[model samples]
Target: MAGGVSNEEVGGKLWIMWSQGVLVSVVQSTNQFITVNMTVNNRCVCISFVYAKCLQMDRRELWNSLSSGIVDSQPWIVVGDFNVIRNDQERRGGRPRPFSAMEAFNKFIDTAGLSELRFEGNQFSWCNNQQGSARRWARLDRTLTSVECITMFPEAYMQYLPRTTSDHAPILIKLEAESVSYGYPAFKFHQTWVTHDSFLDCVANAWEDGIADHGMARLARKLKKLKQILQIWNREVFGNTGQNIQHLEDRLSRLEIKLQEGNNDEDEQDYLVAKSELDLWQDREEIRLQQQAKQTWLKK
Candidate 1:
C-alpha cells in the first residue's frame, strides 16, 4: 500500500497498491495524486490515484501538475475522486455546475489526454449522504486513461461496485478483458466506431474486395467477408473512437492552456484549429449516437 487516510486525519489520502510479479516503482506521491510506474512484458504502464481539490483553482493546478507528471507517449491510467463532473447528466439534485468549471474540467481531461473508461453498474459514483433537498449525487469517482493505455488495454472496463460505509462507491476496474476469461467472442457493432477516421474507408475497401457470385450466395459471401474485414479494422485501425476523441480533445486543451500561459500567436492559431476539428468530430459522434438510438427505439 502506498498511503491512506490517517486515523486522526479528517480529509482523504491517495493510496495505491498492486499485485506481485510486476515491477512497480513510485514516480510521485502527493496529497492530490500518486503515480505508480509498472512494467510487464517489457511494456511500461503508469497508474495514478487522484484525490482532487474541490476549489476551482486547486483543481486546475492538480490537472496541470498531473498532466505534466506523465510522459505523453506513456500508457497512463488515473483513477480517483476528481470532485468534478464532465456533463450535467453525471450530476443530480445539486445546484447546476458552473459552465466555466465544467469547461475547465473537460479541458483538463483533454489536456491530460485521458479518456473515460466505459463503466457498468452505477452511473453516479458519489452521493451526498443527506436528506430532502440536501441529498445530491455526482459522479465524482471515475477511471481515465491515456490514448496509448486505451489502445494497450482495449478491453479494460470499470464496474461501480456497491457502496458501503462510505459516500463514494467502490469502483472496480477489470484490466483483464472478459474475452480472456470467456471463450468465443461475439461480434457487435458500436455506434461510436463509425465516428472513427478510417471507418468509411475500411467499409469501402472491404466491400470492394468481393467475389463474383449470384443472388443470396453472393450476399452471404460478401457479408462474411465484410465481417472479417470489420473485425480486423476494429482491432487495428478503429480501436476506440471514444479514446481517439479524448486524445484529440486533450491535444486541443493543451494548446489552449499554452495560449493562456503566453501570448504566442502560433499557439493561439493552433488552438483555434484544433477546437474546430474537435467540434466537428463531436458533431459526428452525436449524429452516430442519435442514429443508433433511433434504431434501438424503433426496434423496441
Candidate 2:
C-alpha cells in the first residue's frame, strides 16, 4: 500500500498511501513513480503517483516506463509533480522554457493516451517565493487520466489548495457522481459586467425598444427583455471568465515564445494586448468569487 525511496536515492521519492476502505496492491515501484491497483466501492482503478526527475534526460526514463508499463484497459489515473510542463502557458516569470522540453512532455502525454484533468484554484501549482522579478510560478503538479478513467469518474475534478510551507500547493482530487439539475436557474447579474466599456451601451440598446404597455406590465416586459439581452451580451463579449483568462494566457505564452525566438514589434504588441486582457479577466474573476463568497455567507 505504501512505498518510497530512501534518502540515498538520487531523485526525489514517491509514496502511495490509502485508507482501509479501499484495497490497494502495488504493481510497480521505482524512484520516479509508484503504480498501484486500487479497488473501492467494488470498482477497480489503476493509479500512478509520480515524482519525476528534475533533469529532462532523467525524466525520459520515467515517461518511457509509465507509457510502456501501464498499458491496460483498466481505468487509470496518473497524478503528481511531473517536474516539467507541457506548454509555455503552464509557467510564468521564469526563463523561457525550451521548446524541445515542452514538445517532449507533450509527446509523452499523447503517446501514453492520457488527458490532463481540468483543475480549479491557482493556475500554477509551484512558486519560487522570491521577491520582485525573482518570483517564478509553474504548474508542475497535475492529474492525468485515460478515456476509461474519465468515463468512470465523469464528475471528477482537481483543486489546487493554497500552499502553507512548501513551494508547491497541495492538489485535491474529488471523484463523485454527477448531480441532476432541475428547472431554470435565476439570472444573477455579475458585478464585473458593469466595468466593461460597452456595458452601458448594451443596457441602453436593450432598453431602447419600448413595450406596448404601461405601468407594471411594461416594467415586467422591459425587465425580461433586458435580462435576455444581457445574457446574450455576456456570452458574446465576456464569455466564461476563467476560460477567457486561459485563452489569453495561452495566447500570451505563444507570443512570448515567438518573442523569445526573435524580437518582433507585432508579437510584442500582441503579447501586451493579451496580458492586458488576461489581467482584466483575472480581476473580473476575483470580483465574481468575492461576490459568491458574500452570497454564500449571507445564505448561511
Candidate 3:
C-alpha cells in the first residue's frame, strides 16, 4: 500500500505495530518515505516504506537516499509505492518510459545488491481505470530485499494482494519458520523464448547434440539434455522474460523519440522493427499469464 493506505495508517496512528518475537521501530520518516527496523529471532530486517515522487529526478533522489541507508552484511527489505517502473512492461497503455529515467533506480538496486522478491498474484499492483488511450496499469508497488535476507529466510516470499478501494495493492511479505534450500529452478519452456531469431537454431542444436539408443529411453535422454541446453540459452540469450520485454520497449521508446525530434527515416524504420518485436513478446506475455492463471475461459 503506497498512497491511500499509508495515509490512513499514519492518520489513524497505526503506523507501527509490534508483537512478540518481532519488534518494529521507525528508523527514518519523511513525507515520501519511512524506514522501519524490525528484529525477529535475533535477525534484524530493515524495511523501507517508500512513496516516491512522479518526476524522474525526484525518484532518483529517493533511490539515492535509500541506497545510502543500507548497511553492509545486514538483511534489508524495501517495499511500498515506488511510483516509477524499472521497465516498460511494468506499465501498460501509458507514454513509454525512458531508459535514463529508470537508470538511477536500476543502479541503486545493483549497488545495494538487492533483488526483487518475485511475488504471486496480479502482475500489476496499480491501475488507472480508463479505456482506450487513457488506460494504464503498472506494477508500481514492489517488494525487494537484500541477498542476505533471502539466504536467511529462504522460504520467505511476497504476495501482491488485490486492490480494493485504493489504486495500489497491499503487499504481504511472509517469512516462514523453516529455511529453504537453494536449488536450480525447474525447466519450463516459455512461448517468449521462441520469438528470438536464434530460437530454432538453438533448439535444433540441442536436439542434434543428444545421442542414445532409438526408443523412449533415447527420447527421455534427449529431452533431459535439451533442458540443460535451454537453461543455458535462456540465461545468455533470453534472460528474464519480463525484463527482456522491457528492454525492447525501452529501445522502441528511444527510436520513437528520435523520430519525433525530426523526420529521420532510419529512426522510423528502427521504431517499426522494435514495435514489431515488442508486440511478439507482449503476445507471449499474455499466453504466459493465461497459462499461469489456468482459467478455462482463457484456454486455447
lDDT of 1: 0.74
Q: Which clashing pairs does model 2 show?
A: none
TM-score of 2: 0.57
Whichever of 1 and 2 has more lDDT, that candidate is 2
- Using lDDT, give the best candidate's number: 2
| Model 3: CA > 4 A from native | 1-21, 131-133, 177-300
- Lowest-sum lDDT 10-residue window in model 1: 1-10
Give the CA lDDT, 0 to 100, for residue 222 in model 2: 95
Per-residue lDDT of candidate 1, residues 1-300 (tens digit): 223322113244755555546777878766687788888778889988888888988888778878778687888999989988888888777588888888988998887778889897657778665533465778899999888988888888998754434788788888775554657767767676676788888878887885899899988898899888888887686555567667765675455334434456677567556656666666766877887778877997
Q: Cα RMSD (Å) between model 1 and the true structure? A: 16.7
Cα lDDT of model 3 by residue, 1-300, tens digit: 111223344432224445445667777666567788787778788888777778887787778788888888888888888887888877766588888987778888899899999687667778664433454677888988899889888988887754434667678889775568898766777766766899999889989884957899889899888888888898898567788786885675455334434456677568657767777667878887766656534673
Q: Write the per-residue lDDT of candidate 2 for residues 112-167, one digit (tens) a residue.
A: 88998988776778867553446578889999999999998898899876553478
Residue 175 lDDT in model 1?
72
Clashing pairs in 1: 110-250
Compare the candidates by TM-score and give the number of the best one.
2
